[model samples]
Target: MKGIRAKLSTLLLTLLLLVPTMANAHTVSTTGPSPDLRSALGRLLGEHAILAVVAMQKGIDGAPDFRKAANALNQNTDDLTVAIASVYGKDGAAAFKTIWSSHIGYFVDYVKATAAKDEAGTKKAIADLEAYRMEQAKFFADANPYFDESIIASELKHHIDHLLSAFNNYANKNYTAAYKDAQTAYTHMFATGDALAAGIAKQFPSQYSDASSTNPASDLRSALEQKLGEHALLAVFAMQKGIDGKADFADIAASLNRNTDDITAAVASMYGKEAGEAFKTIWSSHIGYFVDYVKAMAAKDEAAAAKAVHQLEQYRMEQAKFFAGAIPSLSEQTLAEGLKMHIGHLLDAFNAYVAKDYAKAYADVRTAYSHMFPTGAALAAGIAAQFPEQFHTANTSSVPSVQKVWFQVKSNLLTIDGSKTTMDTMPFVNQGTTYIPLRYLAEGIGAKVVWDASDDSVWIIAGENKAEFWLGADFMEMNGQRIEIGDPIIMKDNRTQVPVRFIAALFGWDVRYNTTDWSITLTKAMAMEASSNHH
Candidate 1:
């Protein structure tokens, strides 16, 4: 999701680009928690082009951690660019990258100048960046420019000037102005970007089109929207922006739980009710697992962490299958790219948590959960084509998918106590004190239960479905699955009871477990579960 957010940041030119990822709108006024402009710009730059370029130049100029810094900045930029290319079309992003890369170079010079205390270098970098502004401004101007080039350019200049000043202040140890300047500078940049994208899409017919933008049909947009609608994210954002506060209350894209059900709705709209509901049920499960992760993190419970990770892995596998099976347009590679964005966001958010950067961690969390909306809606729409009745009840116009996912994720994670999610194939159903092979039950709940050795059983929990029961020889029941254990729980090398057929039939469809090779084969669906979530 961090990867997705970074990539999504590249989509627009201005508003989001110049600020923090998705933190609240704060001011120096101290009304509430708000980041001043400069800090916001630093955050944007950290992920986008500006910092990438500057860090390189700084490294080149003998900054102590120049190369290391460059690597960090570029790493972020690379992820961001890949994410953009995934959605905006590599060719289009290719064009943007070409232009974007050059600007970064220019910023590097600016940083070098500040380091040397060289007035001329500073002036030159400033001039070069200004030129970049002009060229980029014109590129966007060719598309839309928002207002007349002259007027918009004036605003752009003011914004840039403020940015330069902030940079200077930061260099000079003038923290106050530096923060102030940073805010103005980044916000200006965001404005320019927004204008640029809007102008380009609206104005240029032959080039710079808005084909795969924030609309509903394509997987690209679907994935992006999901990120936008995360729990209390868009809601909090909108609340901060006062969009939810508006009269008539037509659209509530950025608030908490005001009703985000777009993905299901979209799916239902396109397909039918049953499919939408299925998507929702599956989607909701993942949210619950993420919530579990947060809980584990807060409690510092290693056992809880392991359990959450296992569950998340299972959920990913199932979700992958859901996409592969349901979406006609998605290939395994396509699904990976889509899933990768979410995974990246999750990893990034967790990394922040581990690093104690609460602001960034939350920002990444917001993007990860919120971004799921579009995909959820699209899934719903597709489902609508299959089941119409439920689709109508879960219509397109609602809280938004990301928000719902957020709600679900938050609720589950916050409340997790000590639930264990076993990945064993041969589940022991305590029937008259005797255990039995519980393939019917494990497979019923979408888990690939495996028997290890000696006496232990490992259930490969895949997908969002969940259940619990002690398998027995006579009868077993867990999560709506009723079965009789026929085979005795055999002991393998070290683990325990091995249920070969049951788990193989159930989760094997998604993830194939080769007992002979002692390996787990992931189908296109199962392959989707290899996400490095925040632990």
Candidate 2:
């Protein structure tokens, strides 16, 4: 889920480059009890995505459990409808149900059409789905002032496209691609859920109290919770598929691996790449032990099964110790105790399935899935405590004073709001254009700076505005349009140097050059009048 978020963020950063003011209007809250509505919607919506995929696959295969899977998906929709009712009343719930169910029917129609090789029927189903997107978007837009009809429609389109991509690949027997897309579709729903919940909380603040959904700590918790819960569900599914020797077993395993990558990458982001790799080694080993247990049970090897259990016990300690060493708030004993319950749930669920107790197996699966939410919260709290600065929320509305920064050409001295500091690299001028250290200047103004190693791109996010610049690119992309810089970005003393004027322009910083002092002053006022005017 974290990986999917990263990919989605990259895509959004590109799209949002053109609409700076609207980008950060409604931030999604992912963690804490204050965002319970967000968590609930995320869980149900995510479940719906996975269950829809399962139902479609079962329908295509004529599996005996197709009806049951379809029922589960419908139940998720019903739950979602109830959630909407709490905010919009009975009539709104009915309207929501009608539109939502229509989209589901369209998906079912698409599956049936594809299975029957009815190309025209498939086309019509897709066309209907496209139309359904608008109706659904309009419903949400009318219900919430924070939601734009066009933006809602765009998000709905992506959701539809993901599900369709998954099912289409499944119909074509592209199992690997099918499962990958399915996992993506599943994780994408949490974002949608958070968006809806955030808007609802804003619309009725009295009902939600003063809890803000845009808090950084809450976002971290929610993200980890969603990913961990997803891991539990996928693990159960993979174990079932493996034990039954299903043809899609390998694909399910692949999906689980992808999930692992996301989890490890998240660890990397918080603990560095080396720690991430170490975490992956410990984490991947547990999955392998689970597989070994399944294989042993299939062969009725009692000794092997016992050995697998022993390996799992060892893994719990290692995993717990690793986290305890990294997070001061987490104790090895506590983490191990929690992990014991997790291992037990998966093993118990698998054992139930093997014994033909299908009801208990699924019931245990739900228990296992629900367990991860708190686990995620625990980890999020620890991480937030460990790195408070990283999770600090940017309060754009409470700028009580102007932020003024000054930089002198060929000098490493920097001044911010009357405080002086030294930068590693000094600002310089080339052909009469002054270039400032990207990181220092951006961070001085409460903007977020990110370096993407994947493409050697630099992204700066300030309030609702975002700009992307590549290492050697002579142009910067802002608000969806490219502005030529006349010269390529340069690296100085291991720091990224960019034209200060462009940064000032994008973020609404007032710039003044002093010919006598050989210094440039940038000021960002509380009202952001200059920025609004520039835009």
Q: Using Cα atoms with residue i matched to residue i, what is each candidate's TM-score against the true structure?
A: 0.32, 0.69
Candidate 2, after superposition: displacement of residue 25 in Å? 16
Model 2 local distance difference test score: 0.73
| Candidate No. with top lDDT | 2
Q: How displaced is residue 315 in candidate 1, in Å?
A: 1.3
Off by more than 4 A, model 1: 1-147, 150-195, 201-260, 331-341, 344-348, 355-535
> Which residue runs does candidate 2 get wrong by more than 4 Å?
1-34, 209-211, 392-535
Model 2, poorest ten-residue lDDT window?
526-535
Q: Candidate 1 lDDT, tens digit per residue, 1-535? A: 1111111222111111111111221111101111112122222332342333234433434644355445555555565456446435677556656665666666677777677778898788778777766665554344332323333444445555655665566566554544434333433443333333333333433443323121112222322233333332332222221311333122322112213254454444334568668877876676556556655666678898788777766666676777777666455555556665665577566656455564575466446644555344444344334333322222221111110000011011210112223333333323212122334333332345554444233443333222223422322222223222223444322323433223221211122222233233222221222322200
Question: For candidate 2, what is the TM-score?
Answer: 0.69
RMSD for all candidates, in order, please: 27.3, 11.7
Report the lDDT of model 1 for residue 321: 76
